[model samples]
Target: MAKIEFAWELGAHTGHVTTMLPVAAALKARGHEVRFLLREPHAAADLEGAAEIPREGAPIWSGPTINANPLNLGEILLNFGYHEAGPVKALIDAWREQLRASQAVIANVAPAAHLAARTLGIPSFEVSQGFHVPPPAMPAAPLRDWEPAPRARLEAADRRVLNSINQALAAFRGNPLTTIGDLFAGRSMLLTYPELDVYPERGPSDYYGITKSAEGKLVPDWPVGDGPRVFVYLYHYYKGLASLADALARQRCSTLALCRGVDSDIKGRHHGGSVYFAEEPMSVSRVLPQADIVICHASHQMTAQALLAGKPLLLLPTQLEQFLITRRVVRYGAGLGIAPEVNNPDYTSALTALAEGSEYASKAREFSDRYARHERGAALATMIARIEAALG
Candidate 1:
C-alpha cells in the first residue's frame, strides 16, 4: 500500500476537511496509508485509520480581506503569503519536509502545498467546487465577471503575484512557478454545475458536476408547526444570528436551523415547538427536500444543495466569495441576495418574499430538473477511479 497525503491549508469552513474524509477512507479501506495535513485537524479525528496532522500549512494571513483589488483567482493569492517571498519560501521548506516522504498529494485551496508537491515531482489531485480556481489553460480570467477589470490592471496584478511565487521558489532552490496555472497542477475535476460558476468567462471543462451534499452533523428531527418548513444553515461567526433566529421563531414556520459551531444556550433561547437547532456541522442533504425555503450565508455547497432540492433560497452573504455565489443564485431567479455588510437585515421580509412568492420556487425546480441527469454517486465513483488509477 502506498502513502496518500491530503492537505487543506486555506479557506474558512470545515467543509474542506469533511470533503477530504470520504477519499481518505476509500484509500485507507484499500490498505493505502492516509494522512491529512489540515488547517483544522480535529475535523477528521473520527476517520479511524487516517492520521490528522496540523500546523503544516502556510502562515495564516490575518490581513484585511482584499489584499489587492483582485481581478482573478491568482491575484487573490496575494492575501495568502504570495505578497512576499519570505513567507512562501519558509512554508515551501516546511511543507516539503512533510510531503517529500509521502507518495501522493490531494489538495484543496492550499497553494503553498501545491507548490511543494510540484517541486517534489509528486503527482497531485485537486478537488474544488468551481470558483476555488480559474481554468487550467486561462489563468487570468476575471473572478467577478459581472464587474470586469481592465486587461492592463489584471496583467499587472498577475505579474506581481507570480513574481512573489517564483522568487520564493528560487530562494528555496526550487524551479520557478511559471504560470498561475502551476498552483493547480492537478487540473481539478472542476466539481460544480455550469450555472453556479462565479467565473463564467473561464468557461466549462470536463465538469465533474456537483456531488451530493455531505450528511448533516445530526439526523433530521423536524419540529411540529402549522407554518411553512424552512431550513437554515447559519454559522456562529455571523453577528446577527441570534436576532435572525428570533425572527424565524416569530415567523409562522417550522424551522430546522443548523447552528454550526454555535453554543447550546443559543439554541436553548430559540428552540421551541416551531423552532429547532442542530449544534454541529450539519449538511443540507437530508433536510432540503422537506423545506419550502432555505436560509444561509450563500455558501456554494449549501446554496447548490438547496437548488438541487427545488427549495427557494434567502441568501445572506458575509464575504466577497459568498456574495459572488449569492449573485449567481439571484441571477438565476432561484434566490435573493442580501449584502454581507448589512448589520440589521430584514429577515422577515426576505423570508416572506421567498415563502410567499411562486417565481423563486419555480426557477429552483427548473434548475433541479435541468440537471437531473447529474448523479452524485456516478461523479463520486469517477473521482475514486481517477485517484486509484493515478496511484496505480
Candidate 2:
C-alpha cells in the first residue's frame, strides 16, 4: 500500500476541510494510507477521530499585504506571503517538513502544499475550485472582467510575487518559474460547476463537480411556516447575522438557518417565529431542494448546490474568495452579492428580490439543466479511478 498525503496550506473555514475529506476517505477505503495536513487543524471538527491535524503547520500569511487589491490569482498569492522570499521560504519549509515526514508517495494539495511537494520532487495533483491554479500561459487576465486593474499594476504585483517564489526556488535549489502564473501552474482537479468558477480566464478543464459537505450528515428539518423558504448558511458570528435573522423572522420567511456557532440570544430573539436554527451543519443536499432562495457567504459548494437545485440566491460575502464567487453568481444573474461590511445590510430586501423574481430562478435552472444528468458522487468516483490508474 502506498502512503499518500492530502494537504491544504491556506484559506480559513470548514469548506476546505470538508471538501477534501470524502476523497481522503475513499483512498483510505481502497487500502492506501491517507492523511490530511490542514492550515487550521481545529477545523477538523470530528472526522470519526481519524482526522489528524499536524501541529507543525503550513505558513498562513495574515500580515500586512503588499497588494491589497489583487487583480488575479498571481497577485492574490502575492498577498499571502508570496511578495517576499523570507515568508515564501518559511511557508514552503513548513510544508516540506510535513510532506517529508509523511514520506508522501503521492500528494493531492492546495497551493502551498503543492509548492512544497514540487521542491521535494514529489509528484502530485491539485484538488480545488479553480482559483488557486492560475494559468501560466495567460498571466494577466483579470479575475472579474468588470473590475479590471491596470496592466502596469498587475505586472508589478506579479513581479513581486514571482520574485519571491523564484527566490524561494533558489533556496531549495530549484528552477525559477518564468511568470507569476507558472508558480501555480500544475495538474488540477477542479471541484466547481462551469458558471461558478472563480477563474473565467482559466477556460475549461475536466471538472470533478462538487460533493456534499462532510461536516454534517443530517438532512434539513425546517420549521413549518407560511412564507418563502429561505435557507441561511452563513456563520453565526457574522456581523449581518442579527439583522438578517431578525429580518427573516420579521419578514415571516420560513427559514432554516445553519449558523454553525450561533449564540442562544439570537436564537431566542427569533424564537416562536418561523426561523429554525440548525446548531449543527445541515446537508446542503437536503437544504437545497427545500429552499426557494439560498442565502450564504457564496462559498463554492453552497453556490453550486443552490444552482444545481435551480434555486436563486442572496449572497453575503465575507472575504475575497467568497466575493469572487459571488461576483460570478451575480454576473450570471443567478444571485445578488451583498457584502457583509455594508452598514446594516438589507437582508430583507435581498431576500424579497430573490423570492419575488422568476428571472434569478430561471438563471439558476440554466445551470441545473446544463448538468441535469450529472451523477451524484461521480466526481468522487472519478477522482478515485484516476488515482488508482496513476498508482498502477
Candidate 3:
C-alpha cells in the first residue's frame, strides 16, 4: 500500500474537507493509506479512518469570508502570508517535515503542501472546486468577461503575486515559481467542476464532476407536508438575510431555513406554521433530494450538490468566487443569482422565477443527467492508476 498525504490549511469552513472526502475514501478503499494535516481538526471529523499530521500552524484566514478580490493568486498568497517572508517560510516548513515521508500528496489550496512535495521530490496533486486559481494564460475572459482596464489591473496583480511565490521558493533553493500558471503548470489537477465553470482556457485535467461527502452531516429536520418544499441554506450573517427570511415566510410554501449566525429575533419574526428556522448541522445530500428549491450562497460545493439533485438554485453570492460560479449556473440556464444589493422584492422575484418556473428545472435535470454519467467508479480506478504511476 502506498502512503498518501492530504494537506489543507486555508479556510475554517468545511469546503475543503467536503471536497477531499470522496477522493480520500477512494484511495483508502484501494488499500492506500491517507493522512491529513488540516488547519481545523473539526473540519476532518468526517474523514473516517484518516490519521492527522502531528504538526501545527496552518495558515488561517480570519477575514470575514474566504473570497479573494479580483480572484488572483497573488492576492490569495498575500492573504495567507500577509507579504511576510517569515510566515511564508513557516508555512512551507510546517508541511515539509510532516509530509516528507509520503509517497504522494493531494492538497486543497495549500501551497505549502505543494512546496513540501517539491522539496521532497514527490508528486503533488491538486484537488480543487474550480476557482482556486488566477486567470489562465489563454486570452479567454473569465466569468463575466472583464473589460480591458479591469483585466489589466488583474494581470498586474497576478505578476506581483508570482514574484512573491518565486521569492519564497528561492529561499529553499527550490525552482522559482515563475507565475500563477507555472504554479499549477504540469501538475496533475483533479477538479470537481465542469470546464464551463472553471478556467475553460486551460489544459485538460481530471474533471470528476460534483462529488458528495462520503457520509452525511447533521441534517436539519425536514418539515412534513406535500407543499412546495423550499430549503433555505444561506449565509446567516449576511445583512440581507432578514429580508430574505421574511420573503421566504411570505411564500405559499413549506420552508426550512438553516442559517448560521442569524439573529434569533429574525427567526422569531418569520417563524410561522409553514416556515421554520433551524440553524443546526444538516446533511445537504439527504436534505437536497427532498428540496424543491435551494436558496444558498453560491459556494462551489453546495452549488454542485444542488445541481446533482436537479434542484434549481436562487444563489445569493457574498463574494466574487461565488459570483463566478453563479454566472456559470445562469449560463447553464439552471439558476439565478440575486445581487447582494438587491431589495426584498428583487430577491423574492428571482426566488419565484426559480421555484415557479419549469425552464430552470429542465436545465437542472439536464445537468443532473450529465453528473450521473461521470462514472465515479471509473474515475476512482483511473486516479489509483495515476497515483501508482506517480509513486513510481
**What TM-score does each of the candidates earn?**
0.88, 0.90, 0.84
Candidate 2's C-alpha lDDT? 0.75
Model 1 poorest ten-residue lDDT run = 46-55
What is the descending lDDT order? 2, 1, 3
Local distance difference test, candidate 3: 0.68
**lDDT (10s digit) by residue, model 3, range 1-392:** 88887778665566777677677777877788787667876664633333333323454434332334434555555667635545666767767778766888887877778876887788988777656654346222344455233666555655665665667677778897655655555564555666245556555565766544544456655555444788877767887877776676667557877676678898787665566777655767688898888888887878877887899888888776777787789888998987666655466677678777999999988888877777656766676677678888
lDDT of 1 by residue, 1-392 (tens): 77778888787766676566666766777788777787765663533333433223433444555445576766787777676777777777878888878878887777777778778877687788766676554346776665857887666767777887888777656776556766665547677777888767656467786664445445567788676898888777788887777787788588888765676667788656578887654445666788998989887777888888898999988877888888889999998878977768888888888888899999999989987888877887788788878766
Q: Cα deviation of 299 in candidate 2 (Å)?
A: 0.4
Worst 10 residues of 3 by lDDT: 47-56
What TM-score should be assigned to candidate 3?
Answer: 0.84
Strongest candidate by TM-score: 2
